[model samples]
Target: MHAERLYPILLLLGSNIFMTFAWYGHLKYKSSPLMIAIAVSWGIALFEYCLQVPANRLGSAVYSAPQLKGMQEVITLLVFAGFSAWYLGEPLKWNHWAGFGLIVVAAWLIFLD
Candidate 1:
């Protein structure tokens, strides 16, 4: 059960990475027209959804749909925070950390039995 749960979480992490890049990497390609950027990002996001769908289906065997969705939302924020700090070269300020801490607490509350 634990391993099964971990599978979807890992997939969600990978999907989030691809998604973050697809959605925001366009900023680095500002010279491209908006339509071109949207097209490219949409192409990349297709793969994200590919992994995400199966992840949720597999995850549903162990967790309720709402639970899986909640988990994915939390992971999305976490992945975005790391990607922004590392890839985007944004400074992770104290307030950002504090906000993430609150999000973690919220996740914990949601997952609590």
Candidate 2:
């Protein structure tokens, strides 16, 4: 693929990393106060939005709105799968893999000419 498109994909991947951590990283710290979790998550999410906004703006040059969203969803799931297993020690069942496979197919369809 062209570098123009690749940049947005890379940016999206980075943003998703921050996003996954923000949303789920605190689960391990259940004893932490709710306010602390919320505050830290919000701080992390600030970085997510920083990259996400630029990713969408740059991606818009090469992709439609639906395509951009599809890319985001696909990246999110992939990132979450790794985060869930490694960070949370929660591996997905076969059914979850099957569901995510279908989503991958959907993203493929969305990107098709």
Candidate 3:
């Protein structure tokens, strides 16, 4: 990938990580009130969109909308994998990796010319 493409992809990847945490990290904090968790999630999600939107816009010059969406999905899944292992203290087994690989293959198909 070109340097420009790499930056946007990195931005998207980072944004997805924030978004995944915002959306699902609350599961680990079950002791917190539902409303409180929702509020906190929304706060974090705002930051996610801040980066996500720019990443999409920058990537748009080099990729189509569907390609950008596919890239976002792939990055989201990758971020969720790391978040699961770290924040959720969950282990990723071979099957999980295989499933992710399949999803990446789908992303490639979506982005292919």
Please name the candidate that would achieve the greatest lDDT relative to the true structure.
2
Which digits, one per residue and each the tens of the lDDT, describe model 2 over residues 21-108?
9999999999999999999999999999999999999999999999999999999999999999999999999999999999989988
lDDT string for model 1 (28-111, tens) is 778999999999999999989998998998998898877887788789888888888887888578998899888777777777
Judge candidate 3 against the unseen true structure and give its global Cα lDDT, from 0 to 1: 0.89
Better of 2 and 3 by TM-score: 2
Supply candidate 3's per-residue lDDT for 64: 89
Ranking by TM-score: 2, 3, 1
Q: Give every collision pair in model 2.
A: none
Residue 107 deviation, candidate 2, in Å? 1.6
What is the C-alpha local distance difference test score of each model?
Answer: 0.86, 0.96, 0.89
The segments of candidate 3 whose C-alpha lies over 4 angstroms from its true place after superposition are none
Q: Among all windows of ten consecutive residues in candidate 1, which has the lowest summed lDDT? A: 103-112
Worst 10 residues of 3 by lDDT: 1-10
Q: Give per-residue lDDT, candidate 2, residue 21.
A: 97
How do the predictions measure up, each by TM-score? 0.90, 0.96, 0.91
Candidate 3 per-residue lDDT, tens place, 1-113, comes to 79778877988988998899899999999999999999999999999999999998898888888889889888888888888998899979999999999989988999767
Off by over 4 Å in 1: none
